[model samples]
Target: MDMDTFWNDFQLVRTGNPLVLNVTNHVVTNNTANALLAAGASPIMTFSSREVEDLMKISGALVINIGTLNTQDIGLMHAAWSSANAMRVPVVFDPVGAGASTLRTSSSQELLSLYRPDIIRGNASEIMTLAGEAGQAKGVDSSLGADAAVAAARALAQMHSCTTVVSGEVDIVTDGNHVYRVNGGHALMPRVTGLGCTATAICGAFLAVNRNRNEAAVDAMALMAIAGGMAGAMAQGPGSLQMHFYDMLYSLKKSDAERLFSVTRD
Candidate 1:
């Protein structure tokens, strides 16, 4: 779908207020929940293995975030993902810091191998590592460029049969067949560590509302970048930007998204 229709889906998601189940880490729980509500989606953050399957059964989509990884959390994430996939609910995966630790990196890959997600969002270094690069990562921040790993992203997408999104100065979204690049974001976004995880959860909310998530994912990514850009202009720095970011998200109109959106397909 084009940008206009993308906004329509966001509106549908807003009005429908699809219930999105999140199995996220400790670091980004608050940001992720706020972002989901700001975008007019219901956020349900639950990690209890006892209730995860039941929650996924009722929710619109499932979001798995590896922001805070542990042995037990990994088991719950795997169970939630398995249930979500079996039910055909769109699943989004965020491998927060893939190359940071052997356990984190291995768990991320294991999840992907076990249940390929509908969409996966991460920075260049994370994507490159997920695509089998040997480069080191600086904590969760990307040490690689978005453009440098296009081939790896594509390869990963095809191999996993899942849409891959690489966000940097410019964001790249690909579904193995189609690739879109979105430019227009604030520099302050990277300063906030959990923003990327928030974006992945936002993508899950988008997939929840639209039946065709290929288009919904595209729109979600573009709208997120656009919102970040606009909010950056209105704020002093990352602190204020975080507060202003939610305001922009809550006030976002479909018209604004279409008007300011910058997209290109390659």
Candidate 2:
């Protein structure tokens, strides 16, 4: 897609102000909500199964993140997924730390098997683990680069019939047949703890505005990479990058993307 078309998608999220419901983990709740807000989308963070049934009806999209998983969270995740599938609301699934623990991996796989989300976003290790390939995660961090899991991502996308986004130095967006490689994000991005979860939330915002799941995924990752790269240039470390990232998203312009957008399709 051209810069103009991509910028249009970015503006759509800003103008439409779609409501995104996130049933995310405790670790990144505030970070995810703020990221969504910065991207010009309304965010409602909740894990209550009772209210999610009603919330799904009004939300433009749903995000499920398993960063801090438990038995109660598992039930809530299933409830939210069921509600989203029933309401036909687009769902973005983030399998955070999928390769780190048995519960994380099993819960994520179970949800994917039962309900097909609109998109799946995670690191290479998490994606590979979910795809039933060999990969390891250091807690919630990936042990492999994003490029290492392209094939596994494609397989997972085909099996689940959803777009898959692998976040790393080069973010990979794929749907079995087509692939988009988004490069140019700052090297310091991985230094942040909840940045990956923030990326997933931003993707949820894009999915709320754009119906083309593949393009939406690309737009989300490209926006993150461009904004992060810009922010990193002025940041001294991860602490400052986090602060500048929000500012960048709020004031993002077409020229910024024109200069920093480095995406290739395959």
Candidate 3:
């Protein structure tokens, strides 16, 4: 994929302002919504099962983040997935903290079984755990590098027939056959809360305009890394990084993306 392809897709989001339905965690709801808005996409956080079907009909894409899960949330996710599938809308799944506890792991697995997400994004440990491998996940943080889960991510993608993304120092995106590596994120990213969740929302925004799952995943990750790098440069710490991150997303231009994006495919 070329920078032009990514830029064109991004422009679609800016011009169209597609609605992205998010059944995400409450902890990062504000951050995710702000990030989506900054990237020129409309975000709707309606997780109620009663309203999900209607919301999914109008949404261009759906995002499911299992960061903070509940029994009711699972039902809502199923409803949203069904509606999205019927509407032919793309769905992005984030298996947050999959290896942290049995509840989290089982919930993630159950959702995967219910729906084959167009794209699945998670850290190395979460991806590995979802792939039925042993990964070191300490309270939603990946102790292992993203490279360590490349094979596991590829296998997961093949098994689920979906694009898989493992985010770490280097972000890795794959669709079982092709792999793309995105590099440029800052160290301060992990220090802030909800950035990973925000990344998942951004993926939904990208997929709203780009139909190709692999290209959409790669483009979203590349943009996130570029924006994170730019924000990190000016931030004094995690606090300012959070503020600058949104600024970067709002002010991000095609030229900046072309110059800052560091993506390699194999």
Candidate 2: residue 244 lDDT (0-100) = 95
The digit string of per-residue lDDT tens for model 3 on 178-233 reads: 88999998999999999999889989999999889998998898888999999999
Compared with the true structure, all predictions reach lDDT values of: 0.85, 0.90, 0.91
* Candidate 1 C-alpha lDDT tens digits along 23-54: 99998899989999998999999868899878
What tens-digit string does per-residue lDDT give for candidate 2 at 1-266? Answer: 55776799899999989999999989888887888888899999886798998898899999999988988889999999998999899999999889898889989989998997899999999999999998978888987999999999999999988999999899999998898999888999999879899888888888888878898899899989998999999999999999999999999888778999888998
RMSD of each: 1.2, 0.9, 0.9
Segments in model 2 whose C-alpha atoms lie over 4 Å from true places: none
Off by over 4 Å in 3: none
Error of 1 at 36 (Å): 0.5
Clashes of each: 0, 0, 0
Worst 10 residues of 3 by lDDT: 47-56
Error of 1 at 14 (Å): 0.9
Distance from true position, residue 50, model 3, in Å?
A: 0.7
- TM-score of candidate 1 against the unseen true structure: 0.96
